[model samples]
Target: MDLAFSPAEEAFRAEARAWLQANVPNPPLPSGDTKDGFALHLEWERQLFDARYAVVSWPEEFGGRNASLWEWLIFEEEYWLAGAPQRVTQNGIFLLAPTIFEFGTAEQQQRILAKMASGEEPWCQGWSEPNAGSDLAGISSTATRDDTNGGWRLNGQKTWTTRGAFCTHLFGLFRTDPEAERHNGMTYLLVDLRQSGITVRGVERLDGDEGFAEVFFDDAFVPDVNVLGEVNKGWGVAMATTGSERGLTLRSPGRFLATATKLIELAKSLPDTATPELKDRVTQAWIDAHAYRWQTFATVTKLVEGGHTGPESSMVKVFWSELDVRLHEIALELLGPHAELIDGEFAHWMKGYQFALSGPIYAGTNEIQRNVIAERVLGLPRK
Candidate 1:
């Protein structure tokens, strides 16, 4: 149960902290979700890549430092503490990369990971559809075999894809068998978004950023080489990605801890507005962030001891997403009327609050996560 970092770990932390302090943009770059801002973010991504910090825990052969998982956690804490730009390439690094490592061939690994680390080709998730938001098994997108073309022909649409309009690639699940229903007969496809028969339309989010997109496919062809894992066993493969999305990888405690620290500072600056209830909430949020941090460390330790992420990730998802909302809510409350400002000093709080609102809805809704916990973690009956 000990949580102390070893001398080596502490030295690693110091090294990461120094580099980030020296490199992170002083004024901060614009949101990576916007077109112009995305360009700026790409520049920042390249800076990190050049420093070998883009994918620290990845293999050395694939544009990474080959750091241990504990070091990875330490790096995340330092990255957020430095107020680094949003990782425009996160969908690939955090979610899809692990799946590729687990299910991809050597050729696929060589083809994908380096470009991803360098931000030469960014990736987005194509999970939710117009009809299949939470129940991903209900997606109607299809990828039929095209033996003549030596590929699969995709024909359907994916909606609410984060940064879909800006990304160069996509990783998603598609029904490969016409007769099969639900999660069966699906295939995981790595698609080039620039290819023919594909359309990406940006969707404006509550924060006024075009962070979400709807992607359409009509007779889009993907070479057989782009397929990850087995053709019709995509459900399992995709679950691995989703497990990361909902688990420790995607929404790390570092993010919440950073916000909580900001929240406390904001509260301190507004002593007059800090009523007892508001003060208590701020304290609670800070404590929750620390609790989550230690909890995540315990999980990481378990993983080091050969355990795996699973349904318990659902619990982690629900807690962190809700914690995010609460932290931002308190920030907005502290800002008072200034929270309504969309420009200047108070703008980030409002923007963060809006983004926080979507946390429960994406990465499978909190409601859906609770069901996963019930059925898989608690072993409850489906009824």
Candidate 2:
């Protein structure tokens, strides 16, 4: 793939940069403790939506430019470089939107796509249950068809649902046939969080943020219209979504590069005498950050050339997750005795460190990614 951009592409890049310069927020919101930070992010997303810059990869009919993968990469690069505020609708725009585009009916698409694009609705994932974190097939949540009710009756508890506390909708996988094989019995459904028989309670993280929550459904009814794809085929749908999550959205190298840049800046401000070892670690973190960035560009090129990401995305996930942990570890090191601090000037780094600790765990754990690489990529026998 050509690394050089065509003249037309360069012109497009110039236009994007100009628009972003006029629109991108300066001193982007500190990843902080503000209760309204998420809402602030939502406002930023709406601004981008109005400008037709949000979800640049989505089809034009869905309020996107239907940009090429290269164009999408360029947009991401420029957006993050400009320090644009993070999108509050990322759960919708990044994860659910693609899934819906692939599996949803035309009517379902018409109903939800516009709302998501316009930031009129916020969506969250309901994939992880109390017993089904890493092993998604272990889901006990049931979404039984109610013949008389003309919809599926959902009754189950979903835990670790990110942004569930404030989200208006949820896309989840549930067992639709108990008697079928564990993975074969599931169905994916989109639920209205504000409807009757639904309850959401906050789950505080170690960082003291209620960024995730437990959601309960007590015979909640989801209309057949909300069912995504065919019933009892949710496992495949979920696999596809998870692949995208672990491979694309969550592992975007541009996001990690921006994060690493912040860490480097923080490291430079720390006292040199604090710890020589800390400096070395910080340098290594910078190198890893750049490595991830170039790898991401390569991945995007392959995708643009109509090649599947395959197991290489698993490698990306592993690299970024581990690098994230290392970068935060260096940050904590630079904090010295103040490492324990969770508020004030260091609060942002502290929260980031906490989030980075979870990087290896979410969107498929590092161990699982290793298993994927060994079995699928290396052709090794499963243990």
Candidate 3:
């Protein structure tokens, strides 16, 4: 397959590269997950928004350049190659925004997309609960109808929400029909975290970042207008967001490629540590990164040709998550004892390795993904 970009696409890549080179923080911003870092990252996000690079794939009316999927891929490649700051609004732009465009009403689109693009109202995913981590069908959060109040009353809790404590809004599924079980009778809700009956408590991660949170709702009120898609038929809507989460948008190949490039440099810097076995691992990881990039291009081709991702997204989730773990593991090995240092040049590898360890666990664990690929994609018998 020809991987060459068109002339127009190359021009777009140059433009994105130039902007990112000029705008990405020189000293690099802190992890956007932390409080002080979140504030700083918001400023960077606004800079991207002002430059019309925040959501390149989105429509111009919604603060984007109306770029195509190929251009979006080009922009991602440029964005990561320049070592830009992590996107603080990723949960919304990468995961939830596609769902909103596909499932949201005209008013919902206008009201939410612009602010989301500008980082005025960042969003966090609210899919996991204490009882419903990978088994999302077991979600127990309830959204009782309040016809007189013209909204729904939400109750229950969401745990392990990325940036939950810092986000202004949440998009999640709730059990709307008491009699409906499992995947049935759920409603996707757009909730404000600052409401009176809601509570958000930050959870400190292994790296000492308060990146995750537990959000609780006790009769939290969300208006009827906030219900995304048809009420009590949210399973389909939620799946759309999950597909984006697990598939193309969330973990773009550019991220892995960038890390792979860094891994190569780290290996070159430590000649003594580069054993044959380690060398093989580094070569294989680099090859895997390239393979992933090509795979993503193929997927983009299919998508551009009017194809939609279904359970095939599970294959993507498994490949990229494992690739991330492998790439970071090699980096730490290259660092040797220096990996233990929490400051200076080696710190990022340690921090990245720690975060990479969670990749297989989140995004519906590799085990579950394999099962989905088996049953849904390959048509294997479940029993």
Instruction: Name the 10 consecutive residues with the lowest summed lDDT in model 1.
Output: 241-250
Cα miss at 177, model 1 (Å)? 0.5
Could you give candidate 2's per-residue lDDT for residues 43-140 as a string of tens digits? 77788888889877777888888777667767777787677876668788888887887888999999999788777898988989998888888999
**Clashes in predicted model 2:** 0
lDDT of 1: 0.89
TM-scores, each model vs. reference = 0.97, 0.92, 0.97
The parts of candidate 3 lying over 4 Å away from their true place are: 244-250
Model 1 regions more than 4 Å off:
244-250
Better of 2 and 3 by lDDT: 3
Instruction: Please state the error at residue 299 of candidate 3 in Å.
Output: 0.9
- Give lDDT tens digits, candidate 1, residues 1-383: 67688899899999999999998997988898999999888888888888899998888899788787788889999889778899999989888898998899999999999999888999999988999988889999999889999999999999999999899999999999999999899999999999889999999988889999999999999999999999999999987665552232646678888999999999999999999999999999999999899888877887778777778888988999999999999998988899889899879898888989998998889999999999999999999
When 2 and 3 are scored with TM-score, the better candidate is 3
Whole-model Cα lDDT of every candidate shown, in order: 0.89, 0.81, 0.89
- Output the lDDT of residue 169, model 1: 97
Measured by C-alpha RMSD in angstroms, how accurate is candidate 2? Answer: 2.4
Q: What tens-digit string does per-residue lDDT give for candidate 3 at 246-329?
A: 233646788999999989988998999989899899999999999999888787787777776778878988999899989988
